[model samples]
Target: MSSLVASAVEYMIDAGQRSTLFLDVLRQRGDQYREHVAKTAPHVLQYAAELIVDGRDLIEPVNYALVRIVPPEGVQIDLERRPFVVVDPRAGHGPGIGGFKADSEIGVAMKAGHPCYFIGFLPEPVPGQTIERIARAEAQFIETVISLHPRADGKPCVIGNCQAGWAVMILASLRPELFGPLIIAGAPLAYWQGVHGKYPMRYTGGLLGGSWLTAMTSDLGAGKFDGAWLVQNFENQNPSNTLWTKQYNVYSNIDTEADRYLEFERWWGGHVNLNAEEIQFIVDELFIGNNLAAGKILMSDGQKVDLRNIRSPILVFCSEGDNVTPPQQALNWILDCYADVDEIRAYGQTIVYTVHQSIGHLGIFVSGGVAKKQHTEFSSNIDLIDILPPGLYEATFEAKGEATTSADLVVGDWVMRCEARTLDDIRAMGGNSPEDDRRFATAKRVSEINLATYRKYVQPWLRNALTPQMADAMRNLHPLRLQYHALSSKNPWMFLVKSAAEAIDGNRKPVSGENPFLAIQERMGKQIVQMLNSWRDAQEALSEAVFLAIYGSPALQAAVGIDPESEPARPRQMSPEHRMMLDKRVAELRSRIQEGGLREATLRALLYIGSARGMVDERSIAALRQVRRDHAAARLSLPEFKMLVREQFFMLLLDPEEALAAIPKLLPADDSQRRAAFVAMREVLAASGVVSGERAVRLRRIADLFGVEGDPQLSNVTSFDRDARASQGGENSQGLEQHHVG
Candidate 1:
């Protein structure tokens, strides 16, 4: 045992010596090496500074600007009536992510022929700006877009990515009429809620003992909180990727990878700052306190922010693999804010959420493939989302090639359907406990006390001591800022390293997968990473459990009065004006349904039923066309059509048997044509599990009497027919027999 221990000690000493030597060598070459590959800093800084200089340019500039959507060269947007606004997240990053490439959200909207506008911001926040100011600015931007596109049928369809998601929501809540349909991608409103053994970011506040550090950092920066700190925090979440994997991948394939890496780094490296007050408010009120969804957060002007106040339909996009903002954090806000699905429905909010199985947080905004599929589907079907009856739904997008309209012209030809989802299904994911809530509440209380103390004692002393020049110098000396500076042309050795790297780029030879040693090293590295991740997950789970146990106690709950399950009551009454508006909307909808609206609904139903059953029929086709024509008709009264549509829809829903029996009465009298129609109707109904076999045959025979051809398969019909015939009896049974006769 002594010899074994000696060997281990010896190995550890050797490893430590090697690591020290390697780090020393890296330190010596770090400035030159970083300069050689630092393509992002120069351009990123230029752009950042330009944004600060020309703040007005941050708002998109284009003609037909709101309604004239110019798609990518190859793609096409089918809907011209819908207006699109793509709001990029300002979370420690530069703008243009939402429209960075042709295969992006803006690209998809433009291709669809929908007028598109991008909501972006300057790198520097306006002096003394707060979240409320930003929210109001966004509201103004949206209003400007709306006014610019008078020809568009609805208010702008707003798409918000990450931090911008909550910003949009706050804006919509404050001015609900400014939005049409709101899409929030990977935003975390229920900040404290997350799945077990996954999503470590949520536990960070509790582990750090909450927002004091954030305040301290802001104070150190002289009232300007460096966004690079937020960027650093995001990087630390995945040390392997941030420190080694990313750079290694580019190094391994420099020839093809350089431009791609540089392009991404351009945005990634462009860190921006927030005012001390803004950052502190966000951390204390939203992140640590988890007050946003609870309706507990108040603006500087003392307006209580209520999420449910937003009257627009909401589409939430989250992913299971997004460690930064997991599915639970993105979705649990609904459950936190509202009593039940009924409350959501009562408030007339159409809430739809889609969960991707595996996409990182950034991928939710910047992935071309995701943008092509998810964004395209959402942009195309904004009208559907807006018109859907108030309820919670899981939206699923399926790609359809031949079935898609303008199939040859579209890149992501697909359809999106919003299917009803239950609250239990959402709750099955991880959620906040009473204890977790208490901890955040405690954090909020402590933050208030600490902030008050800091303002009273520390803030005045520091503010008076710091000058604008000193502040600028301190900002430039920030570690992240220094790295960018040290790598620029100002470094004397940078030229030599860049030349050498460029030369090396031409003849560089990387190890192939076929190399046995390389393969083994890769496998071992992956194994080590997996093991480390497992250990980390286990540790996080235990920590979270302990947090819940200690802080979730009844005494703690009593102290904080934190109840994750409790929700504020929804307002039961609306002002007379609001009620009248709803009444007008209902009347308008009813009118639309009455004017061949049943036909349109039937067509939609048949299309879905056919897609599910893999069948289609003439009646379905006819219904689809008739509805389209009715919609196009100028003089048609919609209220009457709405009634007819509802009557037919409920008839099918309440008593499908009787409804099917009555189909013979409405059939067109022409033997061959009628038979074809009957066959088509059969397929449609069959897809929905509405009818089959003998009952199907009997229905067909009745059609045959109305000049439709009856199938010979009636002879073998039994069971279902026998029951129906027995129940109806006498003349009906005889009618079935006579129809079957040769």
Candidate 2:
């Protein structure tokens, strides 16, 4: 035989063996899925945890519960430190993705010495649970956690992963006092805000003729929305992953990949059910209405859940590659709620957002590398975030490198920085045009009409025809669930797969990486993925064209009660009291700009320089953190520190030169204390790097105001500290208190 023919034959033999083993691994996966479902309770957290508050026990029972993660053997939790509360999204799958592995959100916080609490839901939701009840239960759970850690320095840092993010926002707004800094990861607040050719998920509701289908499905399921439908929708978003690449990946690397695949599937395949009421509210009030940011959602009570009512600093994490919740959806809420960055500051809201270049939706929380990088840094700097001046900022990370100044000060491998951002910066990321918004509004109206029609006509028939047993069968027979059931050991056909897989595993001969047939197979897989991508693109484009054609017509928009000629109106209003409070606060801050001594002067100087630099690096924040530690006796509480920081930042922003001029009067008369504070303040300023351009000019101006040498050399913290000791009030030290003038 020719060499090529012989190579092909050998490759085929190896491929047969690998396929057998891969099939067996799938069988094992199915068996594991069965085992997972058979449990009365199952959570995939790879850590020891115990229940603290079970929502099922609440007066208004829910499937959600709070569990305290016990630190690993080597890790210790500091009882007095602020705790972390991680709330995983209850979109489709069961909870535990937040702690799916050892290096998860819970793991990161535990390793950082913070007590970790996870709020997850059971596979089946409570019969009568509503979103409002869930929020109240979450608040009560937080109260329990806070009560347990009485000596904690600050309130718990609450992390809401994906859909849980919006849920957390509701809780925080209603009871902002319960939260510290809020980390909302990959959560979409602005459902209608997205660029075209992306966010195909948004188009789903539009193409389905509004939420009528959702009501129809719920009726078919006997008033319970099978989460499998939601899961299928998510799967449909990436057909390649659903149909081929996911299984192919495990099949290609079956030896080392089976356990990991099974672990993720346990969470992914564990489809939960949502009470129809819950899904309807979500679809109408959140997804289609796009009302959360608009502050249009009224609770069961009279309270309106306004995102602006949230007092805790919001740290948003999103990725460009996340089709589920793109950066626009993650961030457009700011624009929806407030007119400008000034309005954000006026409301005393501090929002910091970080955009990763390419991590996917699940990767934002599930990827271990991300868990270590972004999550770790966010946890470490939770205090800094709590005290950040209220405004908009974008958090960016730079890798630690040879040129890193004060590299020892930075934690881990990345230098996290929060850069000041404006509303315009957010607008630059693509969003719906006025025309697009009108089209969505029209779709919303159409959805309402269609839903009413369904409820009046189709829904009644579905509700009457579908029995409980029938609904149960439908859920079991769902394609997403049926696959797991059919492939499990319970199936008579899969018995051979289990035995054959075991036999093949006993003496497997994997093909070489360079095998020509293997290479061809890999190429074929890519071709299939490409084919799916093309199909998805074509389908989405067609959906978009059809939607625009149907809804974009002026007559249709008018018929739907939206004027096509009018600009797309955003729901915006500041209560008269809110406006008056803002104005009053401005006046109050201006009156206090010239108040305080060493602490106030140093904080203002730092703010002045920070505003000029336009970004605050973690290293700089570390210096400030150290200063706080150094003067523990005089250190301010986090709330006080936050108040002072916002006061200083706003004071400067109102009138920079006046705020700078008042720096002197704010200082006390002690020369040593004055110089000591300057030295400490310079520690923060120094991390901003070589202060050239406007920053350098501002630094010179600050130095002149402090009666110190205006030379750039003095900016170095090491040299400044040495100089502070070497000479207490040198030739020019009239005491910056005496010299505090611009």
Measured on C-alpha atoms, candidate 2 has an lDDT of 0.83
RMSD of 1: 9.3
Per-candidate TM vs. native? 0.72, 0.94
Please report the TM-score between candidate 2 and the true structure.
Answer: 0.94
lDDT, candidate 1, 1-742, per-residue tens: 7755655555454334333333322333444434433433222211111121122333422111112334545555444376788777767776678776667887777766787776665556666667776676666667777777675667788988988898888888879978889999999888878755677787677666567777777777777788888888787777667766676565444446656766676677677778877787788877887778878877768887888888788999999989888998899888876666655754667788999999999999879889888888787666556655455778776566554543332335554556666577798876765545566565555556666777788777777887768877887787766766666546675666555555544544444435444455568667766765666567767867766565556565455545645443332344476568766755555443323322343332332223222222222333333444544753233223333433443333333344444544454345454444444444434322344434444544444443434356432321134454455442332211111100
lDDT of the candidates, in the order given:
0.61, 0.83
- Could you tell me the lDDT of residue 325 within candidate 2? 96
Runs off by more than 4 Å, candidate 1: 1-79, 299-303, 399-415, 510-513, 531-546, 549-626, 629-631, 635-742
Cα lDDT for residue 84, candidate 2: 97
lDDT of 2 at 157: 96
